[model samples]
Target: MSNTGKSLSDQAVQELVAKLKQAIATGTYQPGEWLKQIDVERSYNVNRFTVRSALSELHSNGFLQHVPYKGYRVTEHSLQERIAITEARELIECAAAARVIANMDSPGLQRLESLALEFRDALNAEDRPRMMKVNFAFHRCFNDYCRNPHLSRMVDELRERGVGNANRGWTKRSTQEASAQDHLDMVEALRDKNLVRLQALIHIHLNRWRQGYDSLSS
Candidate 1:
């Protein structure tokens, strides 16, 4: 392929990767569901090479697991693994809370508040897909204020991994309401530059899904 062709192919692969990741994250592709390459190609209308490359990227990112003599399957985390991931997220996000507060400006705070309100509206309407998207935006916006690209990237990766594990905590109205409130509270904490309160909210927000997951497993 020519350089231009290569660039287009790379872009196609990246787009496919993002689409597949979103599908997996939103539970359209359930945990442990096998993703056949041909089906993926037909579904996404991509070529064989693109599908393979995208699957490989997702596997590298811990979103999918490759099976010998079989295609990729969505990775399903064990309860213990989910707990461990929650703990890790708590540590990283809480530690970054101070930096995020220090770096947060008026514009950033307003953006976060907007996203938080959007999330609450999505929750009220019982729009799961919109809720997922806005919830991610709210948290991502807050984390971006940490002003450390590497740390922010780490948080993104861990968050994607956790979301990929089919955290179904949001199915309950009560849980969704709590999450909505948590986002608003987090925004308030940032606005007030309350590092301690923000850290506490982070812990609660991160573990809410884990608690729901544990309940389901029990």
Candidate 2:
């Protein structure tokens, strides 16, 4: 369906994709779990065509896989792949933070602050899903100010592929309280418009995850 005349089509697709992505991130789909289109349609309360479209979108975005006879499943990434994804994301986000500080207006700054607050609240509440959502939102706010549409789009796609791997696998050792502290420090850096500190904070953020993953492996 085209977005031209549809008021809710885009909204519905985004909502459904978020829900499904969250489920996958939290292991609801599990490794190698095959997802039937009919089951997804019923569970999401969307039409068959909508379900198909959403699934296709997810697949194209590296969140889902198709097996010739086995249907669709959540795609899995190896630790090495996860590390690469995290590194790439850090590059984009850290640079984006610097650019945003140099470009975005007051209103844009407020939006970034709002996202950081929401992420902190989610961490305080120990809500993993909410934390992930708002954490991504904060990065997105920075990336939106990147001024390059292609760069913004690439960061978003990388985020989708990295969210589950980053949040679930790489951060298993980071408690909610610890993550909250990290978010607070990041917000403080952003509020001060300290690009150097912002870059450092993002490095710490990703390094913590890498440490956690390495610890798990050892």
Candidate 3:
């Protein structure tokens, strides 16, 4: 059956997905927490089928695992896995930073600068989803000069995997300010063709997640 035009089923699944993704990202579900169908059905007031469908979406998105006999649980990334993802991201992003700097243009810079402002506004307004959306777009602006579609797609996939709950760190005002500064700093570096500074800021920007994850999981 077509669940089009905001059907009740589609809304349920969308709400479930957002809540589950936020829970998983913020470590509420933790690694290996069994996402019992009954629990989800009761909690979300959805049928078993809707819960299963929502879970399948999470599984496809690398947030959950469907084990042979254990059904579904939150996916766990080993230390090694995390490091590998971080390193791959750093490599691609740092290289892209250089290219972005080289190809820096007025229109692109304005767009990214505007996005940075929007991100700050989102944070100040406590709009988590908009903040994340703007932040992702800001970073994607830098990588636009990467040129290779395959590499860009890889970076995009890695980003999708690396993103966490936008609401997770809203209470940390200092961290948000620091991150906003980093984006503004990146824009400055691009305008000035300061590759070294741009690269350093990229590392700092990405390291926030690594450090936060380590602290949370450790």
Which candidate number has the best lDDT? 1
lDDT of 2 by residue, 67-134 (tens): 78777888888878878987898887887777766777778767867877787777667676677667
Best by TM-score: 1
RMSD values, in order shown: 2.4, 3.8, 6.0
Ranking by lDDT: 1, 3, 2
lDDT of 3 at 148: 66
The per-model lDDT (C-alpha) reads 0.84, 0.72, 0.75
- For all predicted structures, in order, the TM-scores are 0.89, 0.76, 0.66
Better of 2 and 3 by TM-score: 2
Per-residue alpha-carbon lDDT of candidate 3 for residues 40-129, written as tens digits (9 for 90 to 100):
888878888789889999898888889887789877776567667768899888877766777779998999899999989987897866
Q: Which residue pairs in candidate 1 have backbone atoms (N, alpha carbon, C) closer than 3 angstroms, thus clashing?
A: none
> The CA-based lDDT of model 1 is what?
0.84
Q: In model 1, which runs have C-alpha deviations exceeding 4 angstroms?
A: 213-218
Worst 10 residues of 1 by lDDT: 209-218
- Estimate the TM-score for candidate 3: 0.66
Q: Candidate 1 lDDT, tens digit per residue, 1-218? A: 99999999999999999888878766678789999999999999999999999999999988999998998999998877877887888899999999999999999988988998998888778788888888777778888988999998788777777775535666667778888899889889988888889999998888777546656435
